[model samples]
Target: MSLLRRWFDPIRSRWFFQKPTRQEVLPTEQGLSIYLRLDDVYSYLAVQQLPQLEEILTDDLKPLKVVISDTAAEPPNGMTKTEWHTYCLNDAKILATQHRFSYDEEKPEQPTQEALKQAETILKNTPLTGQNFLYLLEDVFHMLWQQQYGKLRTLFVMASQHQKPQETPERVFDHTPVLASYFEFGGRKYHAVDDLLRLTRRLKQQKLLTDNPIFLINHIEWREHLMSDAEELAEIQAMHPELDLYIALEDPISWLLLAYIKEELADYYNIQMNLYPLSYRSRDHFDWSLATRLSKRAEVEFTPFCRPTADSILEMAHLFYSVPDDEQVDAMYEILKAVWTKGKDFSFKSHFQQMQQLLSIEQLTDVNVAELLARNDALCDQKHQPDFPVLELRINGKHYVFNSLYRVWMIESIFSNVLEQLYKSENDAENNEFEISKE
Candidate 1:
């Protein structure tokens, strides 16, 4: 059997191989609860798109808005305060461009408690409809982004006298201050443009799609941009770059990503690749269920994952980096496939012997292994990355970090300028060869 079939066949049979079933949504239960933070730019963007979304989804979208404080929001994926701010702001701008919305370049000041109270009053007074609520939402964002305190205060005061409490569903998590700009539907949370697309897909799957299926704005079609082999080879030959990947051996996503890079990206890019293996900050924070689901959905999914301990993960990293430079890639590939696909227990003496034999290594030592792991941990800290399987692409001096497999297309977008230059170089080379052959 082919290696691909060997790895994925078990997972396909055990996890997601069953006949497809359309999810059922009761008429009364069809509601999209949107949680918004008053000061969040992404929230404003989502609000802007809601009118069109409502038009498409029709009355089935039972819209509910939950206002929260951005200041009290938790940093997702363990990012530091500053790092989270930078990423959100930058990502918001990119999303705005994709959605054709004007994003303010300057970071807006945080709204005061008084401002939020006034805003709540307005929300309480205004009827929640596609047109009514969206207009009010736009005005609110304008007031916040433009720092129109006097106008905002007056509006709030005017609405306060007529304020009536608006009821909505209870919040999901017990986190004191909630994360901003997420939509919850059928017990799943989705945030931002990418996730909104996923949410739309779910609605369709549930047979809840309205007669008019509106195209989701700001949604980048990533799969359509996958380069052909000739194109990839030409680009690689024209412009060689480097890739630095931070991954955790215990992470199923990381293993899947490694397989992808090896099969689709390795030979196509004449680039220096650096793999930094890391341990999770907190194993409890890892979502095992989600990981399993994602692994099952992967094109080259592996099953029977042998969960590795922190020590075992570190040992694997040490062993991987200890191998000869020419043999490192093959060694890492074999190790991961064995562990995840074949369920090889890395902690066992027999498995260690098997790996050593596969790598043709006479002996292995753990010299400086602790120090190496510490260095990897320190790198994660420096980058303000709290998650595993992050791909950081450094071109010249700038680094772009991508946290999910879905964002691989963003990497291609980032390399567009270089790709263009490479394309021109390729054209010039072909022209030169043509002239020489004609002579």
Candidate 2:
């Protein structure tokens, strides 16, 4: 077994939960309204769950009507899944249709030309804070009210993770005279699981509701349940033939449970996942399809990389090549373009040649491991100690010790910077010569 497989073997054992055998629609007594907020890990799952939830709500319960807040009306702060579910219930009472937000043309316009202009002026002049959420909420409510939708029975709001409930007595729950019964739904929280469960229980008890009807959709994380080595995930999979489960785990101590109740479950489930690290915000022209194809491969698995915004590819590029920021950005671009080139997959021998071509390394004479390590050591000595030591390179067949050719990656990046500087320097020289000749 490889290092990756050895690292992931324990994870496969711990996440051995049996998938539910039957397709379960959340059983609800009252009309059902689900508000699923998509965050990083669970966004894909939430999208998948939407069609099922929609079908059930429309075809089965057929509550008074389903209502969804327009994208603009998305809550400024996201609530707990419970809070969100309740919020949606509240919104549903006022608006009709649980589907995505759509315009109602039959309704008369509320603001006249003069009133609209005055409103815009007032909005521009007013200070904004928590009151902004309230203003947005009321704006939607008033619009629906004007159209004679009346307060709805069920409401669903999909808020961003950046937005959430705040601690302000006055600036809370924009809907005045909050709904009698509302259920908020959102993605899973690893750390806040107990808090979330407690909040759900408290809210349900407060409303005198039944058990387990409040749906909380979430993703698995590191440090969940642990399993003994005797228990393999495949053992659990064997028992649950009907259930569709997908698990994409990268850590042994804590597993990321990515159960996709859809196709491609077995392949992704209990597999060691890898995330690509890119420096600088270079995804604009990056080939997502290439990333996707690489991810599907059984050998040398790949997955979309997610690093925090500050440590993103863009930020990393900025960090690595800080001098002459414009040139740094150009170098970042060159690196990404090379990475995205279709034939640059690292699994095959031909791919390295393709990478070399993309990086313009084919023509360079003195690009190898020993030379590169010497250069790296000198740079490290100048900087202080040896933080950025020798470059680690993996070539097909055998290890070829050349200068920074081993540090081909770092070299390519530096070359990118050099290319940008050369362009700028040449341009500057041309302008200076033109001025002198004219004089």
Candidate 3:
């Protein structure tokens, strides 16, 4: 439901239904102190909304010293604030020629401990306002670039503006190190796979995976969704930044940092956030039509295999929410192997067909299809998962253990397995029916 309609509902409770407040909008720091703008949610999740403040706080970026600045600010009086920063960069350059500076004017020098201490003090005390930060960053970049341009062989950039929406793919050839593409959802058309793939290749040329990272800044539209095309641009960058580039998703880039941490510390700090699974709104939960399209477009495998049999669907559905009290979820593996082994003939497409037939049979078995449909609709309204304390049946008949979180994942797995079996069964039934009709 829309936010507006929720407020007007007769059962409205102000506190529970309140829209996001400013205080609520800001995320808290959990393991890391990663402060991000209220925007910047879409880089990770596929959902259309931002996570709760609690979830955001727990995100991987929580520990970084995040610096959020307003992109636009006018200068003092008649002049703009940005003008001053530009002027300062110019002044610093002019001063460097006349003043006694260390190292080459073009190349930066490695400082002594005392010099390092002084530089640290300068960085800490400098007022990094709208205009000044970039200039300061440029000076540092120039120094670093001169020192290791050949060795590093990478480009670093931070783009703050959104690219125009109507710009064609052909026009995107004039790409920079970090090009911000504007994208807004709700009404904007999705880019074609060819366009996206081409853009990804182009970004790869810019060394997205190199030591230098291209940062594309954009506004938050639908919480986790991008307000502009920056999401598209970022996606391209992520495909292959350097030879092995890393795309930092959220403001804090927890996964990127975790890749460096020792395994002991990493395991201790880990928590899975993408835990919940979307349930079926209708009897078509096993449908793979859309999944097939998406997987094909991405050039990735997305097959759901299963063995045929009415019993297997029920077993799979039961297992979907099933969890054992033991500490391991090994039982699910046994079940998967057993089902596929039994239905050796089932392929991905055939399995989906079986699922549709199974659901159809259930519907037909009911005396009142309309009444059952209504009840099904009601059930759909409530978000129910396999109740906690789920059970798992292993091949050895030895039960493994699971917690609520593990159970949630187990249910999804079972659903996939069950779909595979049911779909195959349905395809077999259809082939038989077709043969009979021809005879």
* Candidates in descending TM-score order: 1, 2, 3
- Candidate 3 segments whose C-alpha is farther than 4 A from its true place: 1-213, 216-313, 320-323, 326-439
- Predicted structure 1, TM vs. truth: 0.78
Predicted structure with the largest TM-score when compared to the true one: 1
**By how many angstroms RMSD does model 1 differ from the true structure?**
7.1
| Model 2 lDDT, residue 419, Cα | 43
lDDT of 2 by residue, 35-139 (tens): 211111111122222333333233333321212211222331233444444433333221222222232324423223333333223222333333343344334
**Cα distance off (Å), candidate 3, residue 291:** 7.6
Candidate 2 Cα outliers beyond 4 Å, as residue runs:
1-18, 21-25, 34-101, 104-439
Each model's lDDT: 0.64, 0.29, 0.27
Q: Which ten residues in a row have the lowest lDDT in candidate 3?
A: 242-251
RMSD of 2: 22.6
Candidate with the greatest lDDT versus the true structure: 1
**lDDT for model 3:** 0.27
User: Which is the better candidate, 1 or 2, if ranked by lDDT?
Assistant: 1
